[model samples]
Target chain A: MADPQGSNTRHQAYFRANLTLIGILLVIWAFVAFGCGIFLAPWLNQWRLPGTGYPLGFWFAQQGAIYVFVILIFVYVILMNRIDRRYGVDEKD
Target chain B: MTVQGWTFLIVGLSFTLYIAIAIITRARSTRDFYVAAKEVHPVANGMATAADWMSAASFIGMAGIISFLGADGAVYLMGWTGGYVLLALLLAPYLRKFGRFTVPDFIGDRYEARTARLVAVVCAIFISFTYVSGQMRGVGIVFSRFLEVDIALGVVIGMALVFFYAVLGGMKGITYTQVAQYCVLIFAFLVPAIFLSLMFADTALPQLGLGRLGDDGQSLLQRLDGLSTELGFGAYTEYGGSLINIAAITAALMLGTAGLPHVIIRFYTVRKVRDARSSAGWALLFIAILYTTAPAIAVFSRTNLLESVPETAYVESPEWLKTWEDVGLIAWDDRNGDGIITYAPGAAFAGKPIYAKDPETNEPLRGEFGQRLITNDSAGDHNELYVDRDIMVLANPEIAGLPDWVTALVAAGGLAAALSTAAGLLLVISSAVSHDLLKGAIMPNISEKRELLAARIAAGGAVVIAGLIGIWPPDYVAAIVAFAFGLAASSFFPAIVMGIFSTRMNGPGAISGMIAGIVFTTAYIIWFKFYDPSSNTPENWWFGISPEGIGVIGMLINFGVAIPVAALTRAPSPAIRTLVQDIRVPGDT
Candidate 1:
């Protein structure tokens, strides 16, 4: 059975931690996808990666951002798993 | 063997592999049919999801669009991939924790309303159909090229294959088959891109090769941009459309991707909520292999096109171009005996006008879609060529002179991508009809056997409808998929998001919000797509809001309406609020 009272301190802490982590990761997503990819593409284009010869923004748009997104998801997974374990909400054996 | 023979052999072998997998993993129960017994390994499920998510548009059409549309094509790159961010952060793990067989099931349980479930089923079916139509058409196009059959016949063959797996094994068979499909499609897509990259840029990696300097001391992008400007087109490397439109379209596609019932269902198939999170990551990595590679392929192919196809030598054009041209994709008005082909954007009357004369001047102008009426010696008469954009990816290997076996492999790859997505979508539509609609609403006591029967039958119906759509494809098969994404974004995305995050949200709010979003987005898309196709241009669009991006506006409207409506209505019961809490936490059970 579950606790009748909702919003326990543990629940609140877990929620806050989860939201904070999500907020941070999403900000990173916005930065890479919209910032480097679109808004700053022109400014970044002035600088090219040495061997690749791609403008910074264009590379971010085409490739860099995707790599970041994959990394971000994994980070979220690791972080959440930790928080889940801390709060005793993780999958039990 | 001939290229056609190679294609037949490769496509035949792929289908046989999928069928064999289907036989091995037959579904015995509804759970097995719907969620593959909830036993798929995260990495394997990730691979399957990548195949399931990448439809014909991803395989056959994305590179073509990127080639023609240039830098603006990043909307697809970011939009299709970025949605996984939202999937990972906001939706996937929570939904997996809820542990449902379908997306609508989640909505049904969360909202605890029959009406909400029904509306969700409707949205799922609608989105899936629009999605599957584009895929079936993609299958037909590939078939028409590879099999030397009519487009309709190609679609039928694709349909038969989809029906075979989806109806028999449901998710159980389709999951394993999709894993096979991911391998086939990726290999098919990479070979040509890699070969072209090596030949032109002296780089082995196509992604890096795209950014490398061509042998001519000019970056491929620089050369493509220069050629585009000279040809009166937008630069390939710059944002061609309004920034707002680009952002909006990308956001809509991303949200729509997250909202897609078929994609969301993939998360539910994993063993644990944690796998759901990791699987989405793996899926993105799998997809990135193709997504990142597509832009490079686009630039490579476009560069090849401008260099290889000489307007004058077009009649004796390379075997690949001739083959594509034979398929009615390339057309020419050889008014002069020069045998050259020209495709200028506007008003280059090469030699004569037949029927399509200038409205005011009565002088014949040249264009493929509209024919001219008068015969006149025009200066630009020497060359007029029409190459269909859809053929760009297919013809890239041939254009770059890759071996015939590579081209044959491409056909197999395109089919695998299309068939995998088509099957995934068909299952979603069938489950929406069978599990959500028939059993949930219309017949609650329906046995598992009866429900499975309904599921199979509904899938057959869905395949037939999708085949019909393929036979009579929309004006642009690729763009039509945006409508599906847009619909998902506008309706399902909001409903599911609010249902999970907003505890106070009531059924009426959810239902009304979805209805409003659907109506607004659907009306906008229909108005622009069919009723006023010309008005789809940005100049006339409201705030430069093309129908593709209107989903963002629709989603906002949904949030706006639902929040206010929920505030005004009675708050949900404590039990319902607790359920929301249960979902928000990782281990609900």
Candidate 2:
């Protein structure tokens, strides 16, 4: 009696959107921590960055990832807020 | 007073202050106990959260790990701090709007099913216990090393302090105490770091200090790279290992941090949903201060260590090195007969006397500086140096030859960092047992007074258990803590996220997904962590992923099982759907 099928479809859409955003973020996060930190490190080492004599990957592995993480938090906050509003679930106090 | 005596006195006073604060701010009711009456200011909560989150590992273990791992160690710096972004963006505000005191409450209520709540409780308990054990162990190590007390006694002292505050005041007591602890610990950590940086690079800020070129015109990293390469090791700044493994471990750590129970619970303490969002931003800012300094500490300490031992003779070794070696930290073998310490690569001294030979005399270097510093090498193995990674941060001030008080400050700072985290974890575990298990499940109709009593009893009991575990830790403190984070990421993160965002997620789906995730990940960890080593064959790891990286695969499985099973299950009743809508809207209160 509660339109179970209809609710199921709606829920699927929401799940897809949440998963998509999470997937995108995960890819970028991996690229910074793993890609730049380890795999691409050798390649990046060929090109020394300004000021710091080390490769970009070395910097990414240590300082760059942390800096990106702070920015990511702000980004996640904005994106999730938008998702919540679009889904009509934004808290209106 | 002697330097050690002064360290003991100052650190002891800080503990007394923490207890006094806890006693003055003891919670009055269940609401106050659980969420600090939801009256904490955003900035205040931010500071408390920062203190709560930056555990002993961050304060002491992180720099040491980085120093040893070289480039690979950045995974922790990125992974642990990155979770705050996930917290700020994905989970915090919605959970605050749902307005529950515990994470289990949100999961159970969101799915409108008791089973979902129970499953969440199990996950919370597992994660909290694993996490708390490491924190307690950290406390004991700091106490024994700095205060010169027996390890067991140190654990007991730490246990008693945490029990008094966590049981008496709950979140209210924990919150205020954390603020105090943060101030003490951060000041203790930064002062020595600043001094060391200035000494090394003439820069007060560690972040800039590390990048500043040394007096030789080569960057500090460039110098380190040359030193390690000369010693037959990878350059300090170069990365090694498979890309996939790095990605998996980093992802696992970040997700695990985001899903951590103690951190998520802090969101419920703020007054408004908006405040939760803002507090997260502030928490990250506070955390970044230390997060950024850690790498600098790693580079500076590694450089200093190499310089101190630079191809010198055993007799010429620095005083600090000798002291640390006496404490069983640094070890070296005089491979050749020459009294001069030869730190060169390969077995250049094979079949030769204990010390390397002098080029001119072709005889053992002898006399005061020439004696074999480390005498016990029966097998004559080539790798003759042993240095514990933990000593890097512990001996940083001493290594730099800073004043004695700076070293004392580090001792106190380490304790504060460890105790604050242990207290937070103990409180989380006790609350979950009392609020979720006893009150929510077994005694739903119990009075608030009884619940409060139960919570106190639970907190006391947890402290004892954690202290015992601390006395005899199963693994090194950092490895054990990393396993806990991996478990949280694989099991809890998916469930919490899906339950909040997806209306189709049924009780059965959430529970099964969690069970599957926990079972698969736990099995992988046990097999690789314990079983595989006994056989001595090629490690039968799944998909070439080590136990450390298995959490990423486990997380995928959790999402896979949860989404499909959720799709197969019938949707919730209309009443349940309305509850979801209500949770989404913040004004229901």
Candidate 3:
């Protein structure tokens, strides 16, 4: 095991990186799910999809947000995995 | 074959598959019973989680509810699915790394108090039972309508089937059966959707079909808006409620989803922390297949119902209408006495449709148009037909003139959805009782074999109680579902989040926060939902946030109370701080 002092500093850096990543992703998460989907839905409704002619906000609320949620989780997985490796905390293969 | 015959065969085969899988993978020890021996691959666990999480409400009720609500339905569509993001990022991996069998185990250990564990145990059991009863009722509803059986008998049959696999296999049996159920339900949900999409939108994908123009030269949603407005209902795509309520309700549901014991327990079945993260993604992917399609189904069914039922002679109404009417879920009053159905915006009669019964044979009294006669007076609205929101999904196949087997498949799918969720909830309830309550507190020295037996007994007993609740459900059952989510949101979500992210969170602070959260949320819900339902409207609400959304405030109360309380009180021990740090990283360091 590494010395306690160095390990503690490494741990702090790792956690801060993880926290920063989470904060950024969550902002995007909130933006799509709450912002485009609900709050600004009426404003977005002024625009329609190119071919199908569905209101942009309506589509996001009912369909787009859900698709984005799935993507967000997978993105977190990928980024968190890389961070884990950088911090020497990824699950041993 | 007749719908009933096909329903019996398909539902029978599904049950047989579940039982066979259960017997093969039956739990042999406590670990197997609680966490499927932690060997389930992420994809398989994902499918199981999908089925377990999407209860009968999502399968049978969601589209119907959405059809009625129009754009406002996004609250449920977004609320339910968005929670997975919270689960993956804020909770699941860390919980899996903690490696406990039940949610209470984590809460109990993290807070370092028996009271905290007991509180969690109560919330887990309370929330699960509240939700499970609704699933049982869904099973009974599907059974009565499709299989031509009594609702009580349907609940009993559903109970018996769940009992076999759940008691025999525990989490192991439940996990595999849920995967099978996910397949059945998704296939059943998709076939009719694809057929309808093809017929209406000329697109094979329901998601795309929803956006495209129909034969009427309007997008399906536009057409729905026009049709609803013509009939005096609000336009289909406009939401009239306050935005704050919508946001609050969505937040409540999302946090509640992350907090649920049954859902949290699913992560523990995965082998590694990363598996928990990815499996959540997979679960949402599977769920989205249905969720994205449901709005399409909602539009198709609503448009079909409006075109076929209204402005038509009662005698010429489609076969599904008559069929559903016989089950008393659909009714017409002929208020204008024109022999024509008028399905406008208002209730046809006051209260539910109470069929006039023949005292001797117990058959419904019929009107001149051969419609089931009702005893209630007019609701004074122009509407003549009473359509239950549930029929939007249940009778969609028949409404669209699909073959009888397709209808039967829908029945089987609804049963699978209900039974899968019921089995999952029962496992959570049983594990809480046997693992957390009994072994952890009452008898720490109990043998693994005896604990396994206890788990089985707990599950079996829970099934009977759930069935009883289904058969003679209390008036508060529906109200309690809202409470379940709110309670989970206000109680478990804050406590667990704090326990993981905030190392300074001590037993006293967490305990007080939990109590404050649950008490505040509960009192608000009970006051509005039960005690003073007359004042449940927005104007009477606190800051225009409905009781359905009050849990958001309760969650804030938890956070607001917890941090200060923790700062004032002694911090957690250094070892406990290390535990928090350990769970954050996936590998040993």
Best by DockQ: 3
Weakest 10 consecutive residues, lDDT, candidate 3 chain B?
B213-222
Candidate 3 on B1-589: residue-level lDDT in tens?
8888988998889888988999999988899999999999999999999999999999999999998888889999999999999899989999999997999999998888999999999999999999999999999999988888899999999999999999999999899999999999999999999999988788999999888966666788788778889888887776756778888898899999999999999999999999999999999999999999999998888888877788999999898899889877899998778899988887889988999999999988888989989999888888888888888888888877899899999999999999999999999999989998999999999999999999999999999999999999998897888898999999999999999998999999999999999999999998998899998887889978888878889999988888899999998988889889989878886
Q: What does candidate 1's lDDT look like per residue over B1-589, in tens digits?
A: 9888989989999999999999999888889989999999999999999999998888888898888778888899999999998998999988988887899898888888988888888889878888889888888888887788988999998888888888899999999999999999999999888898888778879888877865566677777777777666666787777888888988998999999999999999999988999999999999999999999988888877766664545545567665664455665555554556555554334322334457799654644333222343455533355556678888887888777789999999999999999999999998998999989889999999999999889989999999998899766655666688888998889998898888999988998899899899989888888888877777788778899899999999999999999999989889998788888887643
User: How does candidate 1 fare on TM-score?
Assistant: 0.92
Off by over 4 Å in 1: A1-7, B214-217, B310-319, B334-340, B346-383, B474-480
lDDT of each: 0.84, 0.78, 0.91
Per-model TM-score on C-alpha atoms: 0.92, 0.88, 0.98
The segments of candidate 3 whose C-alpha lies over 4 angstroms from its true place after superposition are: B214-217
Cα shift from native, residue A83, model 2 (Å): 9.8
lDDT of 2 at B483: 69
| Candidate 2 lDDT tens digits, B45-77 | 988898999988889888988987788786788
From the highest TM-score down, the ranking of the candidates is 3, 1, 2
